[model samples]
Target: MSEATHSFEESFDWVVVGSGAGSFASALVMRAAGHSVLILEKTAFAGGTTAKSGGVMWIPANPFMLAEGEDDTLEKAETYLDALQELDGGAAPGTSRIKRRAYLENGPRAVDFLVAQGVALRRGPDFWPDYYDELPGGCKTSRTVVAEPFDTRQLGEMRKRLRKGFAEFNVLLGDAARMGHMRTNPDAKKMLLRVALRTVRDKLLGRSFTTAGAALQGRMFKAALEKGVEIRFDSAVTELVRGRDETGAERVTGVRVEGARGSGTVGARLGVLVNAGGFGKDQAMRDRYMPGTRAEWSLVPEGDTGDLHREMERIGAQLAQMDQMVGFQTTIAPGTENDYVLPGAQSLTGKPHAILVDQSGQRYMNEGGSYELYCETMLRRNESVPAIPSWAIFDRQFVEKYKVADKFIDKKIPKGWLEAGYLHKADTIEGLAASIGVEPAALGASVARWNGFVHAGHDADFARGERRYDGCHFVGDPYADDPARGTIEKGPFYAVPVVPGDVSTYGGAVTDEWARVLRPDGSVIAGLYATGTSTASVMGNVYAGAGSSIGPSLTFGFIAARHGAGLGNLA
Candidate 1:
C-alpha cells in the first residue's frame, strides 16, 4: 500500500522532532525565548522515551540539593565524572566531558525552568552509592529530583496526542492502577497487600504515590503543555530540507512530514531539532551498525525506525560510538516478542545474588557492574549470540530473601517461559544445568566455585559479594552487613535464563555540548540539533546515580535550544 498523506500550512519559529525530555525541554526554551515552536512526534503521542523512563534526572551538584541543605559542588561533580571517564579507558572522552559540563553547569537552570513552567520538583536524593566513591568528589548525595505526581486528566484534549503502548508511562500507570486497587480494597489480600503497603509508606513519607513510569512522564508532559508548546502527533519527518546561506554553508530550511491523510511541508524560521530515537528496532540498520546483537531482541517502540538518523546521515552528519548499544539480560517470550529483563540496580531492586556465565558455563566479570559494561563484556567474549542467554542460578535462600523484579510470590511464572523450556528448576546444580541443555560437568564446577564464595562471604572468582560498585546494590536489606552476599545453600535450586536487555541504545549521532549536530567536516549543522537516545549519550559507560539518562537528556536539550537561539554566548 502507498504511504498515507497529510498536508497543512503551518510555520513555527522552531520545530522539534521528538517529545522526550530533551525535545520537550528544548521546545520550552525556544518558546520561552518568545518563539512559536511546533513539536512533531512520530507516534500518536508525545513524550518519547521520557514518558516511559524513571523520570529522575541525574544532575550532580544541582542547586536543588543545596536549597535543601545538601552539600555538592561543581568541582566534586567534575571529579566524579572524570572517574567515570577513566573507567571507559578513554573510549568516550568527548561524550563524558560534554555531558558532564552540560549537566553540572546547566542542571540547576534546567530544574528551575521546568519548575517555573508548572513542574513540581521533589528532592529525591540518590539512594544508592556513587559509582566512583573511591575517587575524589565521589560520595552519595541528594542530587536527584523527581516530579510530583501529575494528574493526567489535567491534559484534557492534549492527552490524546501522547504515544500509548507499553511505553514507560503506560507501564507506570498499569502498575499504579493495580496498586491503587489494592489501596481501596484492603480485604483483597495477596498481591494487593504489597501494593497497599507501598501506598501507605509513600503517603506517610509525603512522597508521590505514583511509583510507575507514567507518573514521571506525565510531569514533563504537564510542564510542556503549560508552556504553550503545540505537539503534532502522527507526524513523521521523511526528509530534511536544506539550502545554501550567505556563509556558503548549508542550513536547514524545513521538513517534509508524512502523516495519515496527506503529506505536508512545514518551515522553521529558527531551527529544527531531531530527537528521534536510535535505530535499535530497525533490523537492517541493526545488522549494518551493530552486528553483534540479535536484531530481533530490541524492546523499543515500533515507531523507532531510525528514520531521523538515516535522514541526517544523508545530509553528511557525523556519527559516533555506532558500535556501542545499551545491553541487558533478555529472553525470548514465546508467541509475543523478545522481552528484556530489566537491570537489577541497587535503587530499582537490590544487589544480584547470581552470576552471569557464558555458553561454556564460566563466570565472567562482576554481575553487578553497570549494564553498559555487561554489554561490552558480552560482545568482547564473542559469545555465540551478541549476548549469551544465561541463568541467574540461585538457591532457595535468595528467593526467600530478595524480591526479583517480576517474580513476586503471588504471580505465577509465565507459562510461555516454562513451556518453551527456558526456565529450569532442580534440587541440585547438576540437575538444573541438565534441564537447560548445558554440560552437567561444567555447570557443576561453576556452581561449586560460586557456592564456596557465598559460604565464605567472599567471591574471589569474580567478586560477586563486593558492594564496591554503586550499581551493585538493590532495594532490599540495606542493613545486611555483606549487602552483596547471600548463602546459596537452600536445597531446591532455581535457574531463570536471561538474555541482555537494554533501556535504549546510548550510541548515536555525535553532538556538541549544546546538543548541536556537527557535520562531517567539523562544522555545526546549522539549525539542526539532537537529543535523548538519538545522540551519543553523555554518561559514557558509568551510571553515576539514578536518573542519569533523563538528566543529560534535559540539560543538553536546554543547552541546544539556547544555543540555537544565539543565547549560548550570553554572559
Candidate 2:
C-alpha cells in the first residue's frame, strides 16, 4: 500500500539508491544538471565495491585514449565488441543491441563528464594492456583510468564515513607510492629502500594506510557534496513505489526506505535510480543466478546484496542475459579476511615458478594466462571435479623473486601465517602433497613435468606463459626468457588454496541502451532505471579490457540520468 504521500523524507527531483561508482556518478550528473537529487546508501558508510577496488574505469576509445594518441575509434571498438558477442554465443539475450551501442558511443563522454564534475581520475599506466589485448580491436595503450589520491582530511567529520577498501590495502600503502616513482626515476633502488623503511616504521607504529580506491571515493563524495547532492547512510530502499497518471500509465515516483530513524516514503519527481551493486553476498540469489559461485570468495562489499534487483523485479522487471558465472580466482591465505585476499594477484599467479593444479594434483591450464582465462579454466574444470579449492604449488625460488598475495616477500613467509595454516610448507613436493591431502606421487610427477616444460620454454600440455597477454596483462618483462614459466625445482614447496572468486556478479536487473529497466516483453519501465552490476553487464560474457565493469557503470548511469531529466535521448 502506498503511504498517501503525507509522511515522507524531503522530496527530490531524483532519488538515487546505492553509492557505487555508477550510483554516485548518477547522483553527481543529476545534481550538476540542476536537479534535486538524493543519494541513499544502505550501509552506514558510502563507497561500495568500486571504492574497494582498483578504482579503474575501462573506457574503450575514451577521451583518455584519444588524448594519448591511441588509434581507437567508435567503428573499431564496435568491431571488437562484435567479437565479444561471438564469445557470449550471441548478442546478450534480453538486452537490446542499442544498449551496447550506447555504451560504446558515450563511454568517452561519461569519463569526460565525470572528470569535469571533479572526479580525480588519471589514465592508467602505459604498461598496462587490455585483459584480452590480442583479441581483435584491442588497443595496446592505457584505456583503464585510475584515481589520484584523495585527501581524507578534506572529509573532516565525514572522514571515517567511507567503506574500508580491500582490507585497506588499496587505501593504506605509504610505500606503494614508491612503485610509481621507481617506474620513472633512475635511482629506483634508493627510492624503493626509502619507501620500505618508511613502510616498516609506519607498520611498527600502527599507522593506518590510506590511498587508492578510498581516496577516489572520498574525492567523488566531496564532488557530490560540492555540487549540492545530499547523501543519507543506513537508509535501505525496501521497495520501489509507483504511481499512475490520468492516462493510467504506471511510473515509479518514489521509494519505501527503512532506517534507524524510521520507515518513510521518499518521493522523486524526475526518476528513481536503483544502482545498488550485484548479488555478491546474497547466497540465495547466488544459488539461483550463479550456481557453484561462492559468496565468501567475492571481493564486493557486504552491502552488495542485490536489493535493487529484488525490489525492481517485484514491479515486473525482467532478467537480462546474466551468465552470472564464476568471475576470477586468486590465491588467498587461510586466515585473512575475505576482503583482504590479494587484490588482482594476477601477477602472483601468472609469475614463473608456480603451477595451479586440481585437488588430484593435475595441471589443467596455462599458469601464465590472464585472470579471466585462469578462472574460466577453473570453473570449467569444476564442472568435473572440485576445482574450487585447487592449489597453487610454488617453490622457495618463487617466493624469493616475487610477493605472493600480501603474505610473503623476499623469500620470507610471515610466522603468523604459518601458525594459522595459511601456508602449507614441505621439504619435498611429495611431502607438500601429503600435507595438503593430495596424491603424493601425482604432485611429484606434475612438478617434474612442469620442470620439463619450463626448461623447454614451451608447455607441452597447457602452454603456460605462451600468450601475448600473459604476466598480468603484459606488465613485467614480456620478453623474459619465460615471463610466467620457471622451474619449480627448489625445495621447501608451498601451497596456497585457490577458489572461484569474483569482484561482483555480472548479472542483475535488465535495462536498455538508455539504462531503463525492461519488462519481460521488452518494454521500458517508465521512471525506473538500473546501472552497474545492478543490470546485466553490456559486454556480455567476456572481460573486455580492464575497467570493463565500471566503464559501463559510468556510461549507462550518465545515459539514464540524462534521459530521465528530459534531455533528448541521444542513444
Candidate 3:
C-alpha cells in the first residue's frame, strides 16, 4: 500500500482489474461514455473464473422475459430474494434491503445495456426453475440468461489468449446436463450427436468455438476490443496508490501493477474497478475464512490468490461474509484429482436410484434443488454427523443408466477408482455398507426407507422431488416413472464418496449499493469500486438462483461504471 502521494508512468480514464464477466461490462460502460479504459488480468488468459463457469446470469424481469410475457416483476424479484434472506435467518451482513432492491432494479437495465451494445444474449430453458421456485414470488419458468455460443475465430489473432472453458466443445451448460441421459432419451441423444458433429465440423473447418462462460467472455472480449478498450493479460495490480482529493480526503487514485513489462504505477482519473475474483486458490485464506474446505475442491481456475484482498485490507477496506462460498459439490475419482474437469456430483445425488448418506448410513437432505444449498447442507450436516465425505449409494440400475464422474457406466470400471477406495461395489446393500465402514442394519434400513418412498411416489422425509426445480431433466431421470424417485434395490450396489466443492469463495471487500468499496466506518473509499467475488456478495449467504453471483457481478459493475462517470441512477 502506497501513501496518498504517488506518481504514475501512465494513466487511463478507468482502470479495471480482472477480465471476468463484470470487468468487461464495466470497461464497456466507460468506453461507451467516451472514457479511455484499461483492463488488467493476472493470468495469461483474459477471463477470470467466469471463463470456466456456466456463464448464466440470474437476472429477474430481463428483456427476454418481458418479451416472452413471462411473469416477473421488480416487486416479485424483491419478494423472492427477501424470502431467501428470511430462510437464511435474516439478511446477511453483506446484503440489505437497499442492496437487494438495487440489484433487482438494475439487473434488467444492465442486460438491456449489454444488448444495446449488440452482445448476444438469450434466456435459459423455460423449464429451468428457480432453486426455490415454490417460495412466494419465485418464478417457476426461470429467470436465468446466458450468452450465445461464440466463435473464437472472431477474436482473430488474440483467440489464443482467451481462456478456454472446462469443456472444449460447444455445448450449452444446460444441454450438457441432459447429455448425460443420452442412452435413454432420444432428444438427448440427438443433442449429443449435434454437439459431436459441431465439434468435428469446427475442427475440420479450422474454426474455434466455445460455449458456457467462455462463450460469454468471448463475446464480451470481442465487444470490448471493437470498442477500443485495451486489455492486458498477465498484468496484476499489486498495490493501490492512494492520494488526497480536492477536499483533502484520501482516495485511491492509481494502481501499481506488475506484469511481463515489469512494475509501474498507472493512474486512474475516474476510478479503479476491482473484479479480481475470490481467493478460492488461496489455501491460507480458505483456512482462515472457510476452515473445513480445501482449495483444491474449487472449480475456479488458477490465479484467484488474495493479493487485492490483503491490499484492500491494508488500506482499511471492510471485508464481510468471508466464511461464505459458492458451493458446487464434486466427487474425487481416482486420477481425476488434478484434472481440469472433475466430474460434478450435484445432479447425480438427485437423480433417481441414488441417495446420499453420512458415515452412519442415514439420509439427511433433499438431494435436489440448489447445488449451493446441497453442498451447504453437507457441510452443516458434518457438524454433527461425519459427513464431510458423504457417500452416494446407488445400484446397478443407476450405474447402467446414469453417469458417474462424467463417464458412462460400463463393464470396465476404473481399477484405480476401486483400488484407491474412491469407489466401492458390492452385490448387496449390506456388503456395500460394510465396505464403506457403515453398519449393515443402518444402511439397510435407510435403503429400505428410500425404496418405500419410491414405491409411494413421494419423498416423505425431505421432499426431494416436490419442488418444481427438483423434477425431470434438471436433476431427475426423465425415463423414470417417477422422474425424481426410484428404488435402489437392484443387486450389485455401488457407493462413491462426495465432497463439497465450489466454483469460488463468495465473500470479500464490502461495498454499497452503488458498488463503492466502503470502510468499516461506513464511509466510501473514493475512486475505488468492486464487483464480482472480489467484494462480499450482495446476495449475502444465499445463492438466489443460477448465475446469482454472475448477475450481481455484471449488474454492479455496470452500476459502478455509470456512477463513477457521474451518471446517476441509470436503472
Candidate 4:
C-alpha cells in the first residue's frame, strides 16, 4: 500500500510508464493531441521486452492487409476472435465481447494513426498465416504488420540507449523467417547471402542497423522524440498517488518515481497510464499465479520485475488471467544458463524428423501449431506424466538437414553441449533411450510409429504438420514434398530437453475497452489506464496470431491515449 502524495515535483498532462510497444504508441497519441506527455522508462533502454521480441503486430483487417487485396473485415476478425473463446471453455473478462469489439474497431484506426504519423510499417510475409488459420474466419494469408529495418545511426547519441533485439542479424522479419530454409531452398540461400552482405557493408560504413523488434522500437523512439514526447529513462514508478474524487471514488493522480535523480512525485493532470510490463522476472509472482513455472525460463528484461503491477494492485486495480504467458518453447544450449534470451526450440520440435516425447517415451499432443499451446500442454501434461522438461528426439538426418538452436548443424556435435549434458546422442535407438532414461522399447516404438507416419504422409496418432503454421518454411523443410514429415532412422540419434519458456508473462491489471483500469466491481478507476502486458491480455489466454501480444498492447495504448486526451477513440 502507498500513501497518496499531496504534492509533486513535476507534472505532465499524461504520464506513461514502461517503454514497451504500448508506451510509445500512447505517448505519440498524447503528443499529437497537443498534450504534454512523459514516458517513464524503468530501464536505460527505450523499448522494453518488445524490443527483444519478434516485433510483429497481428492486427486483423489492418490497412496493410486490405491494401494488399487480402479478404478480411472486422466482422471476420470478430468471428475469428469469437471462435477462439470457446477454447477457453468460457468468456474471459479480460477479453469480453465489448473488449473484443473495441479491439477490432480500433485496431485498424491505430495502425492508420501510426501511418499518418510516418511510421514505416508493412505487412508481414505473404504465407504467414494465423496461428490457427484452420479455424473459422481465420485468414490463410498474413494479418501481421512489422516495422521496416531501421538504421539506428539515425538516433544519433540515443542509438546506444535503444535496446538490441534477440536476433543478431539485420534481416527483415520475412527474410529471417525464411533463413531456416537456407540449406534447402535457393531463394532462402540468396536471402541469407543478401543479409550477410548488407551486414558487412553496414559494418564497413560504420552504420549501425537492427531488425525485428529493435527496428520497430527504434522507429517509435525516433518518432516519439520528434513529436517532443519527453522520455525519462531509469525512472521507475514505485507507487501510484491516488486521490478521492467528488464521487468519493479513488482516482490515480500521479506516481512516486525512483530514478537517477532520486525519489519524487510526478503528477499527471489527465491520467497515469501504466504499460510497465508483466511479472516475468518475479519468482514469487510466478509461484502465486503460474505455479510450477520458473522465472529463469522467462526472457523478459531485468526491469520487468512487476514494480507497477504491485503499485496498481495496491491501488485496487483488478488483475485477471495472471497464470497466462506468451510461451516461446526453448532448449537449454551450452552457455545459455541464466541468460535472458535462450534459443527457442519451436522450430526444432516442429521440423521434420523430430518429435517431442514424455518420460515414458510416448508422444502426447500435436507438437506443432502455436508455441503457447505446445508449452501449456507441456505444463498440463506434467500433472499426470513426467513432462515438465520433455525430450525432443531426432536423428542424424535431422541434424544434417536442419538447424539446431538456430545454428547450422554439422556432422560432429558441439563438444561443449554434449559434455555439459545439454545434448545427448547415441548410435542406436535403444542406446539413445538408455541415455535419456526412457524404456528402449517404448522409445523405439514411438520412433517406428512416427516413421510410419512419414512414409504414409499422414500422422494418425498426432498430426505433426497438419496446421498451415506447422508446415511453414521456418517450422518445416521447404524443399521436402511434405515439408513437415521425415523419417528419423539414420545412424546416430540426438536428444535435447525442451522446457516451456516464454518471452513475457501475459496477464496483469484488468482494463476496459477504453483501456482504463477497472476495479473488481467493474467500476473504472478514473484517471488510471493500462495496456500491454501490464493489463490482462486482450486475446484472453490463447495467442491469436504471430503478434497477438504486441498488437493488442499497441492498439489499447492508442485507445487509452485518445480517451485520456479527450479525443475519444479516433472517431
Counted clashes in each candidate structure: 26, 4, 1, 0
- Residue 53 of model 2 has an lDDT of 73
Q: Please estimate how well model 3 matches the true structure, expressed as its whole-model Cα lDDT.
A: 0.88
Q: Please, what are the lDDT tens digits per residue for candidate 4 over residues 442-545?
A: 99999999999989988998777777887886567657777787888996898999999898899889999999999999999889999999988889989888
lDDT of each: 0.65, 0.74, 0.88, 0.86
Which ten contiguous residues of candidate 1 have the minimum total lDDT?
A: 165-174
Candidate 4 regions exceeding 4 Å error are 1-5, 204-206, 245-249, 338-340
Please provide, for model 2 over 1-571, each residue's C-alpha lDDT reduced to its tens digit, 9 standing for 90 to 100.
2324344566788899998777777888788778998889999988888787766777777777778788878787777777777766787753446777888888888778888987867777665566566668866565777677565656767778887665343332323433433423345568567656765766676544445667667778888888888899999999898876445677887888899658998888888888888888888988876677778778887788888878888899987645464266766665455445443445556767788889899988876555555677787798897787788898887776566665445446665667776678899998899998998999889999989987877889975655555643232234345666788988888887887788888887778888888888889788898888888778777777767777788788888889878775654
Q: What is the lDDT of residue 51 in candidate 2?
A: 82
- True-structure RMSD for candidate 2: 4.0
Q: 2 or 3, which is superior by lDDT?
A: 3
In model 4, the worst 10-residue window by lDDT is: 1-10
Query: Tens-digit lDDT track for model 3 on 230-341?
Result: 9888898999889977778789998999998799999998999999999999999999988778899998878898788888889999999998899888998888899876
**Each model's TM-score, in the order given?**
0.85, 0.89, 0.97, 0.97
Q: After superposing candidate 2, which stretches have Cα over 4 Å from the reference?
A: 1-9, 94-96, 166-189, 193-210, 321-328, 338-345, 409-412, 416-422, 460-463, 473-481, 569-571
Worst 10 residues of 2 by lDDT: 169-178
Worst 10 residues of 3 by lDDT: 1-10
